[model samples]
Structure formats: C-alpha cells, structure tokens
Target: METVVGIEDTEDGKFEDSGVDRSSSALSSPKQISNPIVYKLVRVEGDGRLVPATDDEVMEVGDFLECENSEMHVVADTGQSLECISIERSSSGNLQLECSEGTAEADMGKLNAKLQYIEQILQKVKEEEKQRISCGSPVHSHLNVDSQCSADKFPAMDGKVQSENQEIPSIASSLNYTHSSGSIDQCSRPSEGVIESGSSASAVYSNLKPDLSMSDGEICLDKLSIRELHELFKVTFGRETTVKDKQWLKRRIAMSLTNSCDVSATTFIIKDNKIVRKFEEDSSGNLNAASLISLENMTEEEDGNFKDSSPVKDCGSDDNRVVSETRLGNCSIGYELEDENHQTEQRAAKRIRKPTKRYIEELSENESREHNPRLLISNKSTGHGHVSPTSYVRPAARNVFSEVRIYVTRSDYLGGSDVQIPCVSRVRRSRPRKDNTSLMKFHPTGMSETATKLSNKLLEHCSDAGSEIPDNVLKSRMPAKFHQPASSEPAKEKQCPTTGTAELRQELRPKRADSCSHTSDDDIVTVPTAKGGMRRKHHRAWTLIEVMKLVEGVSRCGAGRWSEIKRLSFSSYSYRTSVDLKDKWRNLLKASSALTPSPADDGMNSRKHGTAPIPEKILLRVRELAEMNSQVPPSYSSSNLAAGAGSVHGRDRSGYL
Candidate 1:
C-alpha cells in the first residue's frame, strides 16, 4: 500500500503536522488517539534489511530507516506529539498513539501473521483435546495456587487460563502475555514502512526480554500490555507480579511489510498465550524441532510417547506440594497433602493471610488415617472386644486420596506368596456389595497366616460382643435364620461401615476365610471394596462397660462434650470417635428412661429387649444424677392456695405460703 501520509521534510526531525487523523487505514489499530503505537524498533541495515532494535536505541523524529531494501524515516515522536495528544502506555504496555495512517500498517501485518499462526495451532490443539476427551482421558486438574493472578489479579490486563479446578477470569489472560516496569516510555515511527496491501499490523511483544544496558539495537518502548505481561509472568515463572520487577520486554511483533529473515520470524510460536515454540531455535526460519511446523495433528501414539517421556517431579522439591507438574496446554499443576510445617512455609513464602488451622488439622488426621487398617485389625484385642462395636468398627473421616503404600505383612493367602502393591485406605460410607457369592473370587490365593490371625481376632471379637447383646435382640441383630443354632456364625458380615472419623484402610491382600464360612447366603457380608459402588450395615453391639463409661462421662462432664468423654475413657479404642460416643450417650439416655418404672422408683431396671442396654450400676448412677439435677416441685400448702391471690413467695408464722 502507498504511504498513508508523507511529510516533505520534518524540521529537525519534528512533525510539522497537526490534527490526529484516526480514520487512516494505515494505523494497525485506530482508537482516535493522537499518538502512534511503536512496537519494537528495527534498523535499516547497510544491506537495506530490518534488524532487531535494542531497548536503548533512541530514534530522533524523521530519522531515516529501511526495511526490505526500501528507505523509511521516523514519522513521529510519542513524547512530543501534541498538547491534547501525548503517548501513554495502555494497560497492555503497548504505546497508544493517535492514528495518522502511515505506521499502523506494519504492526497490523505482523499481528495478522501471528494471529494466523496461532489460529492454525489452536485448530490443531482443539482437535487433539477433543480426541482426548472422547477417549475418556482425564483432563488435568488445576491446583489451588497461592499469590495467583487469575481472576483476582491484574484486573486491568486482558488474558486468562482454563483450569479444571478454578475459574480463571478471562480468555485474554491466557495469551502469551507479559508486562514491564518504568513509566511513559518513548517510541519513534519511520515515515515510510506501510505495507498498504491488506489488514492492519498484528504487532505484539514476546514474553522474553534482553538486558537493556548492553546493546546497540534500535530504541523503541513498544511492548505487550500490562495484563499480557502479568499473565506471561505467571505462566513462564510460575509466579505473580512482584513489587520490584525489572523486565524490559522489547517489542517482537510478527514481522510484516518487510523481508522475512532471522530477525523477522518469532523464535517461538505463541499459541493460546503459551509458548508453543521450541526453546532450541531462535527467530531464524530453521527450527530444531520439526513437529511445530507440521500440518497434521499429533497422533495418540505420539501423545503417549510425550507423556511417558515427560519429566516426573514431586511436590517436596518445590516451595509447595506439587503432585504433578503437567507440561500441557498451559502452566497447570496438581497438589497432594503436605505436612503442617511445609504448609506453613508455603503460605508464609506466598505471604497469604488465610487461616490454616483447619488445613493443618485435616493433614494430621489424614496422617493418622494412613495407619488405620493394621490398627483396626490389631484393635480386635481389646477389653470390650465382644461388647462395644467401637472396638471393631473403626472411625471413618472424610474421603482422602492416598497413594497406595504396601507393607510387608505376613499373610497365608496365595500359598505362601509375596507381592508388591500399594494398600490404599479409603473410608467407604456405603455397604459392601451382596452380589459377590464366592470367596475364591475375592481371595484367589487364600489369605496368609497373618490374615488368618486377623480374621480369628475379628471373629472372636464379634462373638464376644454378640454375647452381651442380651439374647432377645439376637434375632434382629442377625437376620440369617441358619446362622448356626449354636450362635456360631460371625457378628455381621452384612455390616455397613459407619461414616465418621474412621480410617478404613484396606490391605493389599485380604482374608477370604471370613467369607467362605457356613453362614447363610444372606449373611455373606462382603468386606468393603475401595474403588466405588454401594451394600448392608451390621449394628455395633455396645458392651455394658462402654455404656457405664458413657454414663460416667455424662455425669462428670455435664453432657454435650462427647469428644472430651471419648478422650478420657475408651481412649484405647481408637475406633470410638466423638460421634460414636455421642450416639451411645443418646441411646443410653433413651434406654434409662424406657426401663424406669415411673415416679415409684429410680430408673435402674434393665429390660431384656433394650436397644441401649446398660448395666444396673450405670442405670442407678443415671437415676442419681437425674434426681440431683431435677427441679423441686412447688409447695402445695392450704395457706399457699389461699394466698395464691397474694404473693406466692410470702410466708406466714405457720410456715405456709
């Protein structure tokens, strides 16, 4: 295209011009401003080719320059333009200049080239993403990042990222964006470099910046907007804006209206605001990596290879707990539970002020839960093994995702076998599936001696606890008619795990003997499975001692402090969670009230069919407490009735009110 406007000869490199012409087709982007946008600067080499300009290159107004063997000159200086029209940095950091038509064309051309390249890359990426989604591959999950500049940061910038775990502010934030420091920078425009052929210049800056103090490159203050800069910072550095940043991001707009050369093409392709380019290659046309320029999308085979070859990093290596560092479409990360100290350090390093008490508590709880499987089996050796369900029924907490860590426990299953696999612990709230008919299907190799021992302990524990169930409720506790007329079968294979503070971890190898017993088909309680589905819950038989402990705690603590009571008594039964204590207390109160014989006597009697069966001694203590705390009945003297019209609190010589 011909020059939008040509000056005869600027006096001392000054524009002898007025009226900021914004309608000119030459401006890359026209917003009716008086100042012209200066991207990066370039020099008209002795060979007439455009070479990169440095941040320190100072171009005077009307300075002569050239691109593609054609002569060009500085058209305007941003700082000294007009009284009502001076150049200022857009939040994006690009200089906002008034349009005069002569300059924007070059910028628009570069922008167009970059846009086309990115669009091509994006189209390819979209297809790949669709393929992955169709194949049911997990989309990478986003981590809870601190000091992160997503929606809550850089409100003035224009870019965003997509996270499976978070709501990033905008798509514009996802662009290969970055920012710079310092104030109203200056840029000079060449008088004749417009490629009047088509669309405006697609000029923008690369996220990289060189050392400003050591170069003879042309000096232009052109760069990406502040928003773009901040985004680039987060993506590239894995951090947000700092107080004293010194980034001098010189402009690297896609070359336009000029000869294609080493200085023209970007060293990297910026697709979806990410650096899709290879690091080994510069802006030269020859790239070290070949797939970048290839037209076809990467096949699943290639993706598999890429993922396999990608580096694996643990979170402990960094300031935070990074479970997985996915080098994918964007800079997304994954997280796992960290230690309290590590958590504190991460928060402190980030300077975030959120309260982390609950987080720490949760972490500690998870650590405790990690050892629950073995602990639960070992706990079968307890005082109330046959009485309290709390002894065998472990307390479950919120579901936690822990890496399977297998222990070298001796088991008899699989005919003296040794295998390595993680023992994953998950607190399942639902019942085990009743459909599993064969123990061989579950056990395969049969449990080892250790497993056998655990099963025996569990069986004996259940039997002992069942004995205290007062015989009458045995029918309801066990629905299976053929449960050995001898009261022989196990407690409740149909038991559903209760949801609470229980750490129900499953061993890699389980006991099959618990299943292949003489129990009826209906009594075949499937042990809890880890993955997921839903099954039946067996009632926990509370021992008389456990009931007495609940009564004592209630009497001493004045009720409502189940956690404290649990801590004081029944401390050995780690399975007895605060919720269990509370539930048992409520049941004891009900049973005491039900067995009590009205106002005639204290509620100390025990019924044969009691849900919350307590010992007589404990029942008597409950009655005592009830009496002590009971409100006194009002006096009913005849004088009081006569004086009921008078003051109820008044007393006379006869001691009547």
Candidate 2:
C-alpha cells in the first residue's frame, strides 16, 4: 500500500509555509476552513518505491524537529487510522512529515489520546499568544503576570511531547507538562476537566484556534532566513556570532527588539570593593537569592532543576505558585548572563600565559648585553658588533703597575737657618724598549768579536769609577751601542768570550749573518698595518748609487734570483731584503720600458717627479740584460720582457749615460 506523509511547520502558534498546499494535500479542518492546519507532504510511497520530497512539494523543518523514521498513526476526519510513513532529507533541508495511511478500523481510545496531546500543544500556544498580546506593554509584564507560568514552558515541552507521542502509545500517561504549583492549576486542570467526547476532526481542532495576537515584528522574524537572522544578530549585538541555531537567533533578536534581558540582566554595583547584584521582585513578595546564586552556570533547557530547590511554603497555593515562578524567572536571567560572561572570559584568557623564569632571564640578559657600555666597547673593539653572551670569552685580569713614587725632603739653609726644600725626586722603574731583531735566535760565537770590545769598554769604565756612582750619571755616560751594526758599517773584530772569569758580564752581540740591520739613513719606522701587525715604513728616497747596484746584481743573477742577488751583490745594503730587490727591479723594468729618448746632453733621461733618478744609459743597460736572460720581473712575464727587449735594442742608444 502507498503511504503519504505530511508535516506541519509551526512556531509560537503561527504556521509558516511548508511547500505542500493547504487545499490539495493538507488536512482540511472542518472549522476555520480558510485558515487550515496546513501540512507539507514530506514523502510518498507507491509500488514499494520511495520518492523523496522536493522543495516545491514539501516545506523543510529539519532544524525545527528531530525524529527517527517509524510508524505514527494519526486519526483522520473519517475516523480512519493513517500511518506516518517516515522522515527524510532533501537538497533543501530536513523534511519531516506526521501523517497516517488509511485504516478502516481505528482504536477509539488511542485516537482520543493523540487528539488530546495535539489539542494541549495548540491550546498552550494560543494561551501564550493571548498573554503576550495582553501584556503588550512589557513594563507590567514582569510584575503583573497573573498566570505565574514561564513564557518558555510550552516550547520546553514541545519536542519532548512530540517524540513521546510518536513512539510511546501511552504517551498521555507518561507526559506531564506541569510546573511545581502554577502549572498544576493552569495546565493540569484543563487536561483533567475537558474529556472532549467526539472523535470527529472538527471537534478536535474546533477549540485549537489559530493565534493572530503576534505582532508584525514577531511575524517578520518567523519569515526571516538563517542568514538574515545572522545579519540581524550582528546589528543588534556589536559583534558577529558563529552560532547557527535558528531558534536561538530568533529568540535573541526578539529579546533585543523588545529590549528585554536574556535572563533578567542583573545590574551590579561595587560596594566595599566587592561585586553585588541588585535585588529583583515580582508582584509577590519572594526573595530570589537562592536562584541567583545557584543559576550561575545553568541554561534555559535545565530550568526544571529550579523546582527541586524552590522554597517550600506553608502558605496558600496562590502564594506558592508566585514564589516558584519568580525563582524560575531569576534562574533564567542568571543563566543567560553567566553564559555570555563565561564565553567572554574564555576568549580573553586564551592568549595569556606566564613566562618561564629561564625565558625571562634570557630577555633580561640580552637587554643588558645590548645596553651595557663595557660590553659594547669590547664588542666594537673586537670587530664583532653584537654577539651571543655565550660566545664572548671574558678577558683575563690586567696587571695594574704602580705609578712613580715622589719623595719630599726638607733641609736647613746654611746662612738664614730657614728650612729649604730640596727638589722632589721621582723614583721610576724604567721599561726596556722592544727590539724587532730579538725575534730570531743567534749564536754567541757569531758576535764574539763585538762582545769582547763591549766588555773591555765596560770594564775600563767601571774601574775608572772608584767611588759609588749615581745610576743616572752612569747611564748617561754609557754609549748607545746597539746589538747589531748595519752592513754599510765596517765588520767588527772577532774575539772569544773569557769563560775563565767567575763574574758575569753583559756583552753586546754581533747580529747573525741572516739578520739585517736598519741604517739611520733609511726612513725605517714601525707602523701598524691593516691586520694589526707592524711593518717597516719605507718612505726614504733611493740614491742613484743604489739603482746602479740593483742593475749590476740583476745582470749577474738574472731577474728571478732576488735572494741570491741580495746576499752576493747587495749584502752591504742591509735595509734592503730579497723582497725589496724584486720590487726595485720590477720598478726599474717599468721605467726602462716607459722612458722615451729625451734631449739631455749628459746622455741621461730627464727625471720625472716620482721616478727614480736613473740615467738613460742605465735603463738601456737594464733592458739589454732583461732581454738577454729571458727572465720575468715580479708582475711581468718573460715573453713580454723578450718582446720588449727587441724593441729597446731597435731604439737609439745615444742617450746612454
């Protein structure tokens, strides 16, 4: 048999459009035919085939209702049983239907029970709507509520009641939609008293009248989509929200529109440094301290918990109901306030965390290292501007040398008997100057001749001075004899040291054969180099005689043999080393190639300001020798010299000195 399932989507007693037409498939009510209880056909079965409902055919109420597919039998106008086929989803949303297939025989008892439950829901909705209309001026709504029932009482039970009716046949006995005291009087009495007799569909819905009491705003809210509700919510609240629940959005919007608090929003004032909430009361004289304190983290769905904690009264029934409702209202207010506050606290507290001591210490260390003057100076000096503290090795302690001591002496003048102060003598420790030649080790025998002369002179001087001599006088008389003499100076006499004497004598030594000495004529001074070492400052002008000697040595040794030339030909030129010979030869080669024959009667080229004063004849000689040896200078290749040598030989030799 084919089964047709229809669903009616309603909110706050108002029926929103589910796609099914009211006239065709919707259950036509005998009474109020113009405003029928519209049902959306969610599904239809034919020949054991399932046909899913489309948006054009069914209104979706998936968010509004949740149910498992099962057989639900509802009564029809013909007093026949119709089985509720199933539930499903489409591209639109959750499509639900509460309809019954036709049955000739229906249980009268079960039919009456189902009708009564539906009647209760419709009746409760109507009553709530009427209350809302009557209390349009919300100023009196909070205090002058006579029903003493919650506004959300019906909605809280709507889902529970529906689910129970579909599954449990004895749902009438099981479901109790009554509050502690107020609902017993307002809700229970109606179900107990009105044992409505007839099974006709007209009688069942005759009293279930449609409520038109909802305002334009309430009607508009029901028509709005989820996206529109979200926009409205953002506009009402200053921030956007992520919650997708439509009912929540609608309720929040309605409350905001009415300027109503979610739960009663309590105003807090600081009294004596402690937060205190203001007291609220309804028409009845009931204190709600317990409700406020206990509902700190409670939600609206858990409002039933308030009944257990309600104050037990030895008073009249009317008084008790008022008190109970007042407490419930207070709980609802607390829950909303607490929930919002809790969420805000969570978001605020999320990013905050205490830093570890080690982390804090590292920060302080870096800051100190960056700002400290001493560390900055050290880093700058080392050429490492900024570095990790761990990598920087602390310098060792420096020795603090004492300053020269000055002693004051007082003496009496011979004639006047007046005290005369002698000159203040400063006792200073003399520091020896560093010798550049001291780096190389030399044998004593090499300087035996020089040592003997220095020893003889020293002995003669010491013997001549019989009385104790002042250190200053003795130091002044001593000759400034250096350890080594320049190669230009005549060779010193060779004499062995007198090892037979027991007394130690300080003897001056002749420099080793390898060690060269600097002459006074040479502009030699120690200057710091870029790499922090010292080098000889060679700014002295080279004499014409030195150039001739360099040419003679190069001709004998060939251009590349600078060391052999230094030792053999230029040995007397102590200041000039093999490196200096090579450099001079290279310069001579450049000058020889660059110099053109010039008119000077002396057969010498006119000397340029920076060029060495070499005669044209000597340069011609250097080029001739350079070509003969086929040798390369410091930077020039041998092939280039051979090529240039041919050019030089081809030139006029009349300018030769």
Model 1, span 1-657: residue lDDT tens: 111121111110111111111222211111122223122233223222223444333222112111210221122211111100111111111111211211233443322222222222222233333343344332111111110111111111111111100121111010101111000010001111111000011011111101112111111112334454444333332346642232332111111101011101111121101222223222111111112111011224323322332211110111000100110111111111122332233223221111111211121122222222221111000000011111101101010112110111111011111111111111111111122212211111221111111111121121122221212132233333212221222222101111111212211112121221221233333345463522233343454445655555555544556666655554323334567777876666665666566534433344345423344445545544444333221243223323331221122111210
Compared with the true structure, what per-residue lDDT tens digits does model 2 show for residues 31-119? 11022232322232322111333554322322112111112312111111110001000001001112111111223222222222333
Give the poorly placed runs of model 1, Cα more than 4 Å off: 1-536, 598-606, 610-613, 626-657
- Assess each prediction's global lDDT (C-alpha) against the native: 0.21, 0.25
- RMSD in angstroms, candidate 2? 46.8
TM-score each candidate.
0.19, 0.20
Root-mean-square deviation of each candidate, in angstroms?
28.9, 46.8
- Which whole-number lDDT from 0 to 100 does residue 201 have in model 1? 13
Highest TM-score among the candidates is held by which one?
A: 2
Q: In candidate 1, how many Å is residue 576 off?
A: 3.8
Q: List runs of model 2 lying over 4 Å from the truth.
A: 1-522, 599-606, 610-612, 631-657
Q: TM-score for candidate 2, please give it.
A: 0.20
